[model samples]
Target: MDSLDLEVLTRARAWLDDGHRVMLATVVRTWGSSPRPPGALLALRDDGRAVGSVSGGCIEDDLIYRLQRDGMPESPQHVSYGVGAEDARRFGLPCGGTMELVLEPLRDAAPLDALLARLAAGELVERRLDIASGRSTLAAAHPEQGTAFDGETLTSVFGPRYRLLLIGAGQLSASLARIAQGLDFAVTICDPREEYREEWNIPGTTLTREMPDDVVTAMRPDARMAVVALTHDPKLDDLALMEALRSPAFYVAALGSRRNNAARRERLREFDLNAEQVAALRGPAGLYIGSRTPGEIAVSIAAELVAVKNGVAAERVLKVATAKAALDIAADTLSACATR
Candidate 1:
């Protein structure tokens, strides 16, 4: 689940505690070109206040209007939008897109509180809701399982869907952690240096004083995981990369300039890693965003990470290395012309 949906649940629980009637909406399915995917959440209050989104804007507006005019349903109900071309245009759905949503009125906050607690404990939870009874059940969920609905019950996966391990606890890592958290990534910061570890202070991230290699080994990074080495020290970064590259981690990156990255790749080749493993290393890890500060660099790295996670083609993304090389060539050309 993304942070936006998590916020919906958090705000819904708070609203229920404050004696406000709240209805939770989840996109169960989409036909074509839908703005929100299946399992997207929207929490609507009795007064038409909402926390999340279900569509671009018009569908949400229609939902709010319905709440104001008709009132909340007594039980869970499934609602759909964009059934035809006219309705699609009216609801701002593109290409006649259609989406089905399951809306459940909240009578109590216990289930939500329980689900949130499990998520806080770093567990993936599957929540099943019976449409007729309006009761819900929670269980452990496999990483592969996603939101599913069959006419009667709706099962949705809730919690952080991706994990990020940053092999440094410095300013760059701190900024990246904040951005990753907002993107609903479970972030872990590993640093063996007591000097750096003691100064680390970031909430919603796991901080460890263990060696970077040990942390990576223990994590056993899978396809849904990413490993980034922000520490400039080869002693700390190289070992982690050696282990991460050999694993199934979708992204294994290090922070450095082009020359430094080239040297780092050479150093990794001396280890047990093969040429293929060393080639997987994404050095100067970020898009070509011309970022200079730690915050801007964090944004650039996060953007690249998201693009990779979504399976965007490498040729489609402008990488920092490729862009910087072009810029260097252009600068040399300009300097030569000036001298002439």
Candidate 2:
């Protein structure tokens, strides 16, 4: 779950604690061009107070109106919007988009408190809600498992939040860490260099002076994790890459020029990494966005990170080196024409 979903849980617990009846709305399924994805959350208090979102405000408005007029439902019920063209126009759904939602009125907060505790403790949990009984349970879950609906029951997976292990604590790393936190990734920055470690002031991310390789080992990067090397120091970056490339991390990248990355790959082969593991390294991290400053580079890196997280093919992404090379050639051509 992302930040908004987390907020929904927080607000729901608050409302329930305040002796108010709360309805939890979840986007169970979506079709066409819906605004939010499945598993997005929205919570509405009996007094019309709400947190989170489902659609582009239209669905939320309708939900509030219904609650205000009809009062909270006695039991969990499935509701949908934008089922037809006219319905889409009425709800302001884009291009006849549709979404199915499960609305459960909550009168208990014990299960919710337990689930939130597990999430805070860095545990992935599966929450199963029985629509008819209004009963729910939380069990341990895997990172790859997602929300599932089986007609009568809705099983939604909560945290162990996605993590990002950054192998540096510099300006670029700081910027990237900030964005990663906003994207709901638990970011950790590792740097053994005293100067860099002393200067690091990124608040949300955990900063460590431990060896990069040891940090990577402790992380035990899973499919839900990503590792990026921004240190630009082969001594530090290479060892970390050696471990990360062989780990289960879904995305592993390093920041460098194309030529430098080729050299880095050659250097990695001399270490403990096998050919296959070395081949897994994604150097020259980020897309080809013609980025010249630290902030721009951070954006490019975050963009590629998101693309990989979404399972986008590597070949489909354009690299910074390729774009920079094209620009250099264009500049050279223009300069020659001017001289002539």
Candidate 3:
């Protein structure tokens, strides 16, 4: 269950290695209610076979219909969909949504291979979309690199982002890690306790006996990645959170009760975290579910994690996912995806 972007890139690399011409399309910008967001990617083969998506069926059908027979233009071209009055009517644009795409046929070998290699290593590299000159450059914060693109005029679009992380090895950790794995997170479960560590059997998760703090410090989580402490142990949860707040991990939370979570935060104030960092603690952990069991708690927590990761405010998402039975579906869905 790799991300749609990863799957597209993987297939693109295979095609490139096969010595087949590949046309790449990325949604540079979107407005209103487009089917795909700004970074949506679609690869056009020399023939007609295509994987990945730019739209829900209709837009892809339109794209395939327009470019499949032309067999990918030799020069890079920029195109838009659901724009203006007539095109919007014709395409059935939802609420007047518009999207622009960049179409570049496989021409240069240097950049494509470099990007593929970085992606294979699971690095979050930024590809700057220069609409004016129809050129893009890949930028990564590396030891040998400190570069920026300022010459862009029309618009710039970011490339595919990275995944999420989970710390702790209990059932809730297992369940959340499993679901996050499908969401294209390179999830890892860090639990030093033997009772919990022995039950670590989730697929696509790298389980470690090393303490959570050391492991997180070693990996260095980023804004694209998130950390959720499922252990509820102050020793494990607090130490890992100390490191998580200092890093760029976009989301950080722990499973705990109101009193327990309050205590956890009060203790961390001694570690010199600011009010902002301390305020980031999410608990009554997860959306309030009245969950009396482990699995239900996992769903409530995971749903909150998803909302936070997606940049949706907790208030907006909790309403939809508050049902006890909904948690079961989420837990089961996560189980199915990771196990398979």
Best by TM-score: 1
lDDT, model 2, position 102: 97
Clash count for candidate 1 is: 0
Q: Once superposed on the true structure, which residue ranges of model 1 sit more than 4 Å away at CA?
A: none
Q: Which number leads on lDDT?
A: 1
The candidate 1 region of ten consecutive residues with least summed lDDT is: 88-97
RMSD of each: 1.2, 2.4, 8.7
Provide backbone clash counts, one per model. Answer: 0, 0, 0
**lDDT tens readout by residue for model 1, 78-158:** 988998899988987765778999999997988889999999999999999999999999999988899999979999999
The positional error of residue 106 in candidate 2, measured at the CA in angstroms, is 2.1
Q: What is the C-alpha lDDT of each candidate?
A: 0.93, 0.89, 0.70
Model 2 lDDT, full chain set: 0.89
Query: Which 10-residue span in candidate 3 carries the lowest summed lDDT?
Result: 142-151
The TM-score of predicted model 1 comes to 0.97
Superior by lDDT: candidate 2 or candidate 3 = 2
